[model samples]
Target: MTPAFPDPHPTTSTIAEVAICEVGPRDGLQVEDQIIATEDKITFIERLANAGLDTVEATSFVSPKWVPQLADSAEVFAGVRHLKRVHLPVLVPNERGLDRALAAGVESIAVFVSATESFARNNLNTGWQEALAAAERVTSVAQTSGLHVRGYVSMCFGDPWEGRVPIDDVLSVARRLFAAGCSEVSLGDTIGVASAGHVRELLGRFTAEERTRLALHAHDTYGQALANVLAGLDSGIRIFDSAAGGLGGCPFAGSATGNLATEDLVWMLEGMGIRTGVELPSLVEASSWMADLLGRASPSSVVRALSA
Candidate 1:
């Protein structure tokens, strides 16, 4: 049984499935003014996993002084044990952060890097080079411990301080992260300014093999996240990052807004006949519960429509 197209891009031909990494507990919660209680955060992750999200980023191991919203990272990790079916990856800022993650017995970890100098200074409190060095060091050490590492390159499309980010700048950081041992690198449209054209151009720079290792983290501020996701699918990208209920943005990047909603992404993927393995009804209910906890309506359009 030979097929017409040996390989089908997720966009045009039928691709089997898309990996949706739910970031509601980590990237989503990090920016909130309302501190979701630690138990609630644990419950949130459990609910997301139970609803069939394969991967859920649990929390970041950074100084609580800087991100007070996730001050209970260790406690949250401790209270909730990892599930056999879920891939729970925690963000570690550096070797020090990595130490905390190791002690918490995490199976996978993620390191984030800024694609611009201004964002490096503001978000990481260090120059881009220095912060990248730390990330590399952390990645190496984590790999040594037999843990999977995912690298995050933020502000890849545009930065609040630097305007449109040069693709070369993103390439420099992305290559370094891969060289340092990241199994996958997620490109972030941090300020939500990137459109389909820009996304295609940036992804075009990679070879087929490199493209296989890439993921898209498109925020929805300009309402182009799903369009960018389609572009990524056209480019053969399989992984996409989203937060439930469109929960959070980068606290350091003020122009940044809610990430692409998991519900929205799920609905779109399933509609496109790309299996996400997520039940929309249960996902919506979970997001609604979290929204109630946060004392607000969900920012996700799909959630709003479905709940209504």
Candidate 2:
């Protein structure tokens, strides 16, 4: 499927390629009521790779007590680790999670910290300061071991409990993460409340050098994820995080909805003549397969429209 709009900004030719990180197997399935079998999860990752996604978030190496759906992270990693040229990144919340991920032979890992104190406490059971400290520690260790680390700053725009997050607070966490040796820091609109203006304003705060090491992870709760992505694109961001079939929501965040769907993002990008290295038809097929596994229609409009 193609986008409905014409090239509104034809002269804006700064970015050549956009890298998408697919987070369906981890963030998407974490909140699912049914636990996906480890073998099936491996198949999903392979299918995503087959659809031209070079980077896929395989699973989270957190406690089973917290996310029972991804309890077989080790098996999932082992199963998909042999896929040539596909970078599989797993989420590591703490030192223990990092240890588990490292043992599973993961080449890349991501650590998360909330920009607001309320979400920090609610999600990680720690203050924002403590969360940063933990992220710093994990990032340091992971980088020293020759592993690539991606840092996430959640609630960068607005938090459910804490209304508007300050720009300074978000930058502080991002700077600390980069200082701690994270190759890139992904800014997350966790509750999907950010508008294009908010996105441009926030990206405006970062220097051009800092923008190179940044990525956008926008949720679509308010139907603003794609708009926010365009804002980021105008601001020089080349990387974005998305879930297949729009299959993610925060289990801890009550108001959180699905992450931006990869299929929809690719459609918009392709329509803009932007190169995403993803095949839209194959991606929609993968989303449909996942929707069947979850026993529900995909939340992605592109998937529904193309399938129809």
Candidate 3:
């Protein structure tokens, strides 16, 4: 179905092809205090695949001791690997993480590095350079094994520890990821401090060619995620990362809220007459089901309003 959102206005502006990467199972479950059952994870993944998601982050390959919530990564992947036309990407932080993912027969991997030195150390226990190197090595190994790699630059907008992240810092991290052979680099507003103006300003710096390799990962902490997304869309950004039922927060950053919900994103896109290739009702149904499983109210306004 064609989206109601008008096509981009022709004023020397071009809209980049947009793609939504679903991170419900991995990012969403990681922050939940309750451990989601393996079967439930598989079910959630399958529902998302059925809802027409092209890419879904199935789980993280971090050590079970570190992230007990996703300890069933292999089980979830093993259960849902048969789903057709859906790509399951796993998060791998290091060699061990990559090895775990490889053992699970994962063909796509995501590695992340923080834009700020402090955030890098806080999240990965390494500084920016070290974290970048680690991510590069992880991508290298995965590429050698014929796996697709996605790079993540977290805390791209602002940092809790550091006041304002410079544009140069963001670009440097992004360039490193791209040069390291990542298919794309997802820019994360980890703290949710970014505004629409910031989104436009940051995105405006990259050329059309450079922008083609970018994705916006916004959060709704300050209730500005939708605005930020619009700014990104206007700037020709097409790829976004959202969580189902608005599940997920940085465990390391207490001030951050959950991610922008998939239901809300689809609602806005469909309302604007833009096609997301996602079934809104089915996704909303799946969101409701997952929220019930998590035993928490969803942060997605569309889910709440529609379900009501």
Candidate 4:
């Protein structure tokens, strides 16, 4: 059974509510050298749902040649399709990925494009325009198939090759994604180079209405992910993406690090009296279990502190 979580947008709340999308099963594990078994991935996702994460990125449907770790996307989706109340969104890079996700009965899918030309070529082997066009095609097909589509604009802060990305470039990709029928666009700090000021500036470009359609995906390479997240929250962003046990980095991006830890985010949010509906202890337990399975201590401070 899917664990119950509060409404993502509460109709009445004194404190602002935030929605966390757990990307452990997909983004968190994609770059890991040790491939976790398919059944273990399914179990980890189930644990996340039970801990009250409303959205869980289950797996990606990319080619095995590209991401051999997630080659079992279909099997993972099949195993967890029975879970209710939680949105299981899988990443689909192109039409072929979308087809695989659809055949596996995926209800929601995420498409990715980079903000910088160099990273775009490195990750997708194409320029920004070509990647955007592909995203448009995939988004259209996914929407027509009755799947909720989320778009990811990577390197929104700074690219490894391109030092600082222009805000206009980031907005351009986001605009196209939104125009192409994506319900939400996640701005990703793929290299974890963004500071609080950078986050505020990027969000400042969006109108209040447009801001509602945005999500923040931060990495903790410089230990600034939480601070950047606070900046995003101050700018009225209520949705953020995080990984369990701080377990992911972009394989293609050198110097990249794990994503902002879900447990750490929850710890901070709950302390501020912001309701995320996640049981912190349960989340720590989940991450701790995952860390043990992966043969390491969790990278999240909250998980380590609590376990100690």
Report, for every candidate in turn, its global Cα lDDT versus the true structure.
Answer: 0.90, 0.91, 0.88, 0.91
Model 4 root mean square deviation, Cα atoms: 4.1
Model 4 lDDT per residue over 1-308, tens place: 22333323424434568989899999999998889999999999998999899999999999999999999999999999999889999999989998888899999999999999999899998998999999999999888889999999999999989899999999999999999999999999999999999899999999999998899999999999999988998898999999988989999997999999998898778767688989766787788888888899988987777777
Candidate 2: list runs displaced more than 4 Å: 1-14
Model 1: what TM-score?
Answer: 0.95
Cα error, residue 44 of model 3, in Å, equals: 0.3
On a 0 to 100 scale, what is the lDDT of residue 158 in model 1? 93
Model 1 segments beyond 4 Å from truth? 1-13
Q: Which candidate would rank higher by lDDT, 1 or 3?
A: 1
Residue 282 lDDT in model 4? 74
Candidate 1, 136-172: lDDT as tens digits? 9999999999999999999999988889999999999
Off by over 4 Å in 3: 1-17
Backbone collisions counted per model: 0, 0, 9, 0
lDDT for model 2, please.
Answer: 0.91
Task: Estimate the TM-score of every prediction.
Answer: 0.95, 0.95, 0.94, 0.95
Measured on C-alpha atoms, candidate 4 has an lDDT of 0.91
Residue range 159-228, candidate 3, lDDT tens digits: 9999789998898889899999999999999989999999999888888987888999988999999999
